[model samples]
Target: MTGKRGRPSVSEALARDERVVDVVIALLTGDGIEALTFDRVAAEAHVAKRTLYGVFGDRTGLVRAAIRRQHAYLGDAGDGSSDLRSASRAILLHLLGDEAVGIHRAIIAAAALHPSLAQEFYDEGPGRAQGFLASHLRAEAAVSPELLFAALLGEPHRRRLLGLAGPPTPEEVDAQVDAVLRTFGLLR
Candidate 1:
């Protein structure tokens, strides 16, 4: 990811770009936003500074790209029956993972300094994740799947983000899922 160099050969750019983003995420998780700079990221990523600038245009762009990369872990679309509790559980777990938590923190910290960047990250990331999850719930509809989705995808996760709670344990997740099922009359 050495960003210090001029343009790489076409084939090398894709891999370098990925490495740059990966290095940025690693740096972000280790140190908060204040500690990041193009020079530091170039050193950390092992890329030439010039190359980094060529790809991202500026430090702000790099920050945006890195945040976008972390959030993009949630996929574009999903296809699963809402009735399939196991699949639903997996999605919930992914959202609450430590890595996801780190990304969420970085975005929040960055947002305090840069509102536009935060907005871009939200539009590119969480909104997409919610839409993908919403679509899956739509597929799962035995009936009133949105209600189930709302419960499963709602307060608990955001409450975790607000530092009001940590990720729920598997037992707790099961209870939450079960509550959704009972409320929707999916469980006997």
Candidate 2:
């Protein structure tokens, strides 16, 4: 059952890892990756230390799980299942959103020390997103999907990742996606 007076019962706590990962996400975005210790996550999630370790193994595992969670959330956007315009807009908005930018900044700060984590982040995050965009594209376009992905992010993403700007509004996302699609000859 409960390991401590304030903590949730183990069965109840472990039932939804989302709660724990959500806490980790908040810590990651709000205080940067340095704040992702098991102590902090367990306390914030009201779970026991044993629960965190039993579920996520160690700090690296914990961080990896959080990154995976982020990837899962962002992966929904540009799945190629939707129409091109909608998919592209969704991808741009999600990529340039506050949480993605925060996670990106945190990962960038930690990447030098955790190269493998960074590589995994890139592979699963932007790499996967680009792959999705590629699937949505026609074969006739001269621009590679990678180039289109870059243009979608472009200056807005850079500004967001650097904390120089906030998340773009839907109108801004629309303008950027329309311009990029037009430039790439994907739009008429």
1-188 in candidate 2: lDDT tens per residue? Answer: 83445555667655558788888879888998789888889898877799789888887676777766655545555454676677689787777877777788888998998887788778877787777777777777788878988998899999888789988899999999999999988888
lDDT (Cα, tens digit) per residue for candidate 1, span 59-133: 667777875664553444554434346645655666665656666677788887878767876766556655655
Off by over 4 Å in 2: 1-15, 68-80
TM-score of structure candidate 2: 0.82
- The lDDT, on a scale of 0 to 1, for candidate 1 is 0.68
lDDT of 2 at 101: 79
Model 2 error, position 55 (Å): 3.4
Clashing pairs in 2: none
TM-score of each: 0.66, 0.82
